[model samples]
Target chain A: MKFLDFFRSKRPSSASIAKERLQIIVSHERRRPSTPDFLPSLQKDILEVVRKYIQINENQIKLSVDRNGDCEVLELNISLSDPGKK
Target chain B: MKFLDFFRSKRPSSASIAKERLQIIVSHERRRPSTPDFLPSLQKDILEVVRKYIQINENQIKLSVDRNGDCEVLELNISLSDPGKK
Candidate 1:
């Protein structure tokens, strides 16, 4: 009986459930805002800078802007393959 | 000669350098603004709710508020332990 109870307890915890709900809500909030007019130019400039030194596909770069209070944050994530391996 | 050049290429690429630079800049930007006044209370309330259902350490939960233009986003991340293991 104890073993059966243990197996049954495999149900997801409340914390996981809360996290899933929060992710959905946060992603929705992130997508609701229209991108700023300058974002495309910004991305293009950054991509050009990166391309000058490395051979990378377009998918390797990501750029996003997030706001905190009145402050704006530009976040860039780039994945680079080792040049030697290439 | 080619092998020697290959070993020398192990030096970090421009993309890696760019990423490191961006991380420093973004982290600085994230820290520049003072946290909002209501954030502590909000975290406490959420912690209380989560604690009601699971045994989790304080560090297991993370909460942050980020803004995008006029929109505000509350990001919550929680790590849950398997109840059966406990």
Candidate 2:
């Protein structure tokens, strides 16, 4: 099979190229449609932990478990208001 | 060029497959490296409009501008608390 491939142009497989693109786009997004039941409780737990760092309310945080290939990424975004503004 | 393609099995181009995958993942996430200057202001503005519908703070809403090929998608997720829970 290696010898036969040489007869064609030496371009890398398109699948690999697509894989790279897929990785970039999916890095922040979560896969699957079903959301777990523990999410509310999980949010509560995170709020408790984050409170030590900054004064934030329940509305200021988002917790998502994103799956990429074999690994899962726990993505947390927290918004802090600027002290200078108000 | 056209005649030579017939000798090969009719597999859809890898580019199209990657494109489909990209669409699925990127539907929710934003693109580009630089966070736009207007985003903070935009979120503030959206918060005002959304306040009319339901009681939510800036934290409960996520606004993203995602680019799919030539078009752009504005994705927003607003978390509404379940009244029955508490």
lDDT (0 to 1) per candidate: 0.33, 0.32
Per-residue lDDT of model 2, residues A10-41, tens digit only: 22365532211111111111122332233334
Task: List, residue by residue over A1-86, the lDDT tens digit for candidate 1.
Answer: 22122212332365532211110111101111332233334345544543443455656555565544322334454443232123
RMSD of each: 24.2, 19.5
Off by over 4 Å in 1: A1-39, A84-86, B1-86
| Residue B8 miss distance in model 1 (angstroms) | 40
lDDT winner: 1
Q: Which stretches of candidate 2 lie over 4 Å from their true place?
A: A1-86, B1-44, B82-86
Native contacts retained, all candidates in order: 0.00, 0.05
| TM-score of each model, in listed order | 0.26, 0.23
Query: Best candidate, DockQ-wise?
Result: 2
